[model samples]
Target chain A: MSLLSRKIADAVSAHPQKGALTVDDDRYEICLELRSADPEIGVSFDGLDFRALDASPRSVETLKAWGERLASRLTYLMEPLVVLEVDRIGTEVELRSAKPSVRESQLRYYELRLESSGAAHLRRVLFDRDTRTRSTVPCTLGAEALERLVEDFTATAA
Target chain B: MRKIESDQNRFRQIVRGKIKSDLRKYITHGEMIGKTGGELVSIPLPQIQIPEFRYGQKNGGGVGQGPGDVGTPIGRSGEGDEPGAAGDAPGQHLLEVELTLDELAEILGEGLALPRIQPKGRANIIEEKDKYTGIRQTGPESLRHFKRTYKKALRRQIASNTYNRNDPIVIPIREDKLYRSWNPIPLPHSNAVVLYLMDVSGSMTDDQKEIVRIEAFWIDTWLRSQYDGVTTRYIIHDAVAREVDQHTFYHTRESGGTRISSAYQLANKIIDAEHPPIDWNIYVLHFSDGDNWGEDNRQCVSLLRDEILPKSNLFGYGQVESPYGSGEFFRELEEAFEDVPNLALSEIRNKDGIFDSIKEFLGRGR
Candidate 1:
């Protein structure tokens, strides 16, 4: 196993479920979760929660491969820093931009969700400030773009 | 004149129908809220026209059939197609019809099937209004009764042998001037006060505040229509709570942890000082994102149970959804205050949820 993956696996074994650890790179805070003997890893940065696989094994090599896969997908996230949040309730996963766009009085945000089956979906939302109305549209992201988002969410800090 | 009045009444009915058909859109979208002016709101209606009489000139020329040829083209057809500067006259436009608040409230009531609120207890507040009782000899010129003064002048002219019976002309002097006088009468006013408490913490965004704003507008509109005198107060809270004006209540934002009990405490104090349960019909609406400091949730429940709900005719708690909020406070309240008639709890997902949330709050007719 790679040196970094070995360290993460050791840290996960030492800490309790839902515990956080800043490994080789202190810039990224990795959160470890265990459900039904399967591991879920996430990262917290800039008060925003991001990245959590539905389920995986606690293998050191698997952690390394997943981290590398995420790192290779860093193509999106080329804009200014905006707060985002990921709160998983029950089996549903909700990852949304916490800071909405302040255009005129209207606010807009992008939200991504992962169903229990691990399928990802995206939505573009618009909220009218004057009227207090909201409208949402389903959106699509290319495979590479989705990968880039996963990469940015899993490892990066802003 | 009667025919013209009848036509005008028919036109008004048409406008009311159009407004009623689109009332759901207005309530859900809040497009009419910004158009409110005093007690009247201007609504834009399309495809409605006002009838007018078109007069023709006495000497206007007309074409004779004898001079027209079978193959003749209309004069200057090419000239009409030529490009020119924009015309001075305006093009077709949407008509804006102004409806009073009472009228709008009636539309809302009928459109949503909302039951009219029953005022609790007897009317306790007294409002004094001016009644035009009689005429006086001396007063402000703006209030002068010209018709009465002219009749008085005609009577005096005939009595003094200065009347021109054939001409029938009478001019009034300064001594003939009369003014309208008023007497103050106290009437019982059914008074209601809506105490609005909002959580302006970091978790609550402008979007959520906007939902609060739209809901508040509808609630205020319905309550104002029900009560003779309705007074509104605004309170904003983060970790600390304070009373503010209406403008500041919706616009203000603070980046601090939420302590909902602070707002309830202030509302309790306000009720004790200005509005007593016996004399005032109190409505307490608290809006938050359902995020609070862990220990503060218990305090908020206690405050609601002991202080706010007991005094309020209806206590509505709306949890506006926010991305940053944990949304645990809603469950806590539901668990603590199950089946409490005076307490109404609703979860507002977004702007679209406002219509039903308002119905839920006022449907009780409290």
Candidate 2:
């Protein structure tokens, strides 16, 4: 258990409903909101931000995994999130997903939103070129699934 | 007058033909929903020119009689040079023609080639029609038979030797009054009741609701043309189900989990209470994104197979595609009710699929 991982696990235990914790000398910020019965984690890295969706109460292991993975690849993970923020101007955001399987004549992308409280929201976007319409839907991705998505997205964006 | 009526009928046929040709576009775009007023809808048809004499503007100058010189520009220069401004020219506007629900239904049936529905059970509505059966000598002035009373008065005058050839004016007195008497004849009418159940959960978007609205409008129109009396009921559900008006059914949105069986249970209760199978032809049309709770999907299947399907003349389930909804319930229904005769299922991907979905439901003609 490193110092950073212990800090994250402590934050998770302290703010079961709604709270925020900043660590790594103000390099990262994590906000928790559990009013919808599902824990939503909003992560801010430096100035760029994205949401880590589908965090469960039993996510201490997931938090430790994130700590180790995020320590080295924080810049790599943010490339896609930054691109998503630029792409999602003047469009509706529904929900977040890591892997988006688009159909024919469809364009799939991601969107990021930075809240006033330093929390960030990441949403999956599916745009149909034929109809010129965009849609997003809530996708259930547990903490483990989100870790895998982060790994996959960073590798793909790289 | 007969010739004028025949011309009007011809004009109406042409209008119907124009509407039928554009029916698919109208169904997909849903432009007619906003123009609906009560039992009539105003359809905008282009290129149907009505022949009429165009009167010139009062006191308007002729082409060469304007104030400008022969080579000078007409009126003020740069008058219409503004960018993106409304043009002053007489544009060809869409001619809005009002058609009754019955007429629109006929057009839809003809356009889709939908078979006429055979109403089930007994005639539920017994309407009383006032039929003139006899004549009475004394009654109220509203029902007085003018010609008969005049003839009676003329006969009385001639019988009493008071009618003159030069000035033959027949006066109808109280004794000569004849009144029409009528009996209330009971007319048997086959009726139907349509139960519209919609999933208004968070997964169901405004676009999906609009698609459902367009489809429902067409369905309502078609069914109304089939039966003498058609009563419509709307049920909206997320986690819980409740009955609402037509406006609320298409507009309401609730952020909750989906339990499709709740809507089915409410529909069953409504059917069992008001519309008995023995007396009325019942139709259950449910629109959802097919995102039911894992356990509730089974409950929905069982409820449909046991209660709703058996009582309904036709059971139509339209699964509208949504990115959020898992759409597992549609597959469940397909696996469960694959061979069910009255059950009609359709997958509406978007607005373009409404035309085919309507055909799939009404084509059964149950």
Candidate 3:
């Protein structure tokens, strides 16, 4: 569903942890900035005022209306830029064509990013969603280790 | 018979699809592991159920119609002459399917598109084992041949001129006993060892360790596929590090300061004592939340450069992004070892990035 920009603001305000939250599929690139409490993440994507989403009572309803149209309009078939942002901690997921490569549906490039908290939540969702596709791949180290911030990424051995 | 075989094959295909659809839950959820045993695993699949006849008399006219159907209730034949047992509940059934580990692995490979590992290093420790294969007069009683022992006893009794045709009873002394024997030959096999080093300081959380655990299992699976014999070692570290079993590796939590060097020292010690670079193909994978005591960061780099790198075939370092982590360790490694050939470093920002991280680290076939 298309919350477009407002859902992200609601997700961020609900939790101060950039890594702990993100609007599902709301994508971003978190630039690393040196800070006092370890390193903090700064996001790059649509800017929706965080204050307004919390203040407006009709935010969810408005988001639903806008998202429905947007979901229909934004076609992945055209090689659209897919940016996924999760409001759990902070993770920016972007899938796009790598440079100089011509656009072909099957040959397009893909990139994924997960802020720690956001990724942990995403794992629960994605791993659950993995039920839909029925993947044939073994959950091997290289593929699994590639997963982000999963606290129990090492669970099977346990 | 051919039709039945074809139907069974189609049923198996359906079961495979069901498994593939839920593969992620199966991977992430750990319930399936308990079900694994021997070479085959049983997975329960929900299926539709139907009732059928259990007894004879389909052709017998008087079987259900009470003697020749003349006064029988033939009016409601469309409704089925017999009054069946009534039940309101819908039929539900679960089908259990057995699959081998290799079959499971094949499905996994197809789903993930993982590259096969190319084994490296010189594995020269040839081993020889003997197995009981033939009957012999001299051998341990544990391997005694029952049929041969009886035959030899009977033959000895006859040879000693104590045989009787009417009372066919033959019993011989201990010398007539025969046992099984064995032959030994060298069997060459390749083996490997994986050393998993994890930084478990305050910066790292349980969530992060879970990720490491999942990744490690897959890593082990692929490596095991490459070599017949494989061993795994686990090391977890805080400001101080220690070598522990796999269980302790994921569960232990410490919160003082971070010293990446401690884990390396312990790993180096393990390699020196148990595995030699000449004998085993060693793969070292280090997962950290990317926080190291500033002064000790340099020490960690020194340890990797001087001690760890030389003894390992692939030295993989993954920086797990965390809220409480400094995240500068990855940058430091990038700056320090920009062109190191065997050094594989990756930045894991979240779970989705795991896919690419694995590709980048193992893509070179190390």
Candidate 4:
């Protein structure tokens, strides 16, 4: 298998719920959805509410090829995945969770609020259950950061 | 009206964005060329979302409410009897958007950062044009202005106190007749002529021709947008050279020795006879597999240096890679004319290389 296919397979395996990746021949619809859980990131295919998990090996290979093709066309997949919902009051930023939380989470929702302090950009991972718990941390807004966060979240659940 | 105009402008911006992002892909592919109309080309963009409404299940108060059986067929019988497995994913859609040649050229220029061309010599040709910019008292019946004539007659009647409040009938006399008058204006038009020369020898494959075709389409689009009138001439050569139409230039295949100078000679002859350098912005573009005969490279260089390069605004030479060819002609051109201002040379190894090759050729925008 190619390195891209292996990466996708690893991503799916790390998730707590079953996950599937579907990509069409023309690469118009490329989506990765998690079944039986509220996914941290959900790609809508034609605005249809659907879940696909336990994809075949052929589907994984097709998704890898599609990803390569899209990259050649200079279209980055992570740009669409990183959707930020920002609300600001004065200088304080209130970042709301754009997507629902995964299953088996103690918190009802989690928001990654980012704000600038002097030269450093600080973030607060706000967990809302009954009472809100905020943890200030340093984070960078990039593909690698998002990937690491998702992996860390899944690892904690596991 | 303002809101609609804003919405239309927003949609146009989105389309331009899509085109700009995929400009390189379009340059490497030739499928869009076949979908081109007179002044517009249709491009298929993937993953463009369209707004729609989705309905949800209502409360349990409708018909067929009594669920007494399980594993029974609900509606039609052969609904799910297809051969393939049922796919739960939504199908992909390609949205076809039509853009004018001018818009496509603008996107290409912005994407490639190509400079605007400065035509050399007397690029503009002045032609006398008649424009109706004034109204006169008398002229031909075909040029008569009915509205102006009626207003003039009404004013004359009101000034002479011949108007009636009840009748309000004002007839136009000879003196009150108004006609549209035209002045001869000298309109300057910039015209361009492109000479496309390609080697269709045995070493050149259909894939190489496809790359050339895609590149030529973009070059044509850009040139046509820049000039008021653009003329394209195609020349195909193997061991000999002959002028042909666009279709024959791209589709013809010949197996013989390569003679690159023959094409340059014919192009020079055509330009000298028809398109003078002073009056037309001439562009000579040549595509080949860089497999000229061993003895003809010197002749080709001499011909280009003495005849073609001096008269043309830009001379672009693209060398398409071929397995059978020796690929020595490009080295000769580079060694001979390393500092020629009008000469642009590019090596296109594959379809993807076409994007960079086009930029190299038109980047200077000579």
Worst 10 residues of 4 chain B by lDDT: B47-56
lDDT of each: 0.70, 0.70, 0.57, 0.67
Q: How would you order the candidates by DockQ, starting with the best?
A: 1, 2, 3, 4
TM-score of chain A of each: 0.37, 0.34, 0.20, 0.22
Give lDDT tens digits, candidate 1, residues B1-366.
698899988888888888888776677776778999998998888767776676689646765675658787868566678688889998888789998888888888887888877777655457789999999999999999989999999988999999998988998988889999999998757578899999997678889998999899988988888888888999998777899999999999875457788899999999999999888899999999876664888898999989989999999999898753336677799889988888888889888888788888888878
lDDT of 3 by residue, A1-158 (tens): 22323343333334243232323222321221111111123232211111122222333223333223333333332232232221111111222222212222112122232222222111100111212111111111211122221212112101
Q: lDDT tens string, model 4, B1-366?
A: 697799778888988887888888888888999999998899998856653445567754565655556667686778867788779898776888899999999999999999988865555556779999999887899999999899999999999999998999999999889899999998756578999999997667798999899999999988877776788999998778999999999999875447888899999999999999888899999999886654789999999999999999899999986533226788789999978988999988789989999999899878
True contacts kept of 4: 0.00
Which candidate gets the maximum DockQ versus the true structure?
1
Task: Assess every candidate by TM-score.
Answer: 0.61, 0.61, 0.52, 0.56
Q: What is the lDDT of residue B294 in candidate 4?
A: 44
What range of 10 consecutive residues in model 3 chain B has the weakest lDDT sum? B46-55
For model 4, state the Cα shift of residue B194 in Å: 0.7
B28-58 per-residue lDDT for model 3 (tens digits): 6444555768867666666423234565777
* DockQ for candidate 1, C-alpha atoms: 0.05
Q: What is the lDDT of residue B115 in candidate 4?
A: 91
Candidate 3 Cα errors over 4 Å, as ranges: A1-158, B1-99, B122-126, B136-155, B158-180, B185-190, B339-341
Interface RMSD of each: 8.2, 12.7, 15.9, 32.1
For model 2, the stretches where C-alpha displacement exceeds 4 angstroms are A1-158, B52-86, B129-181, B185-190
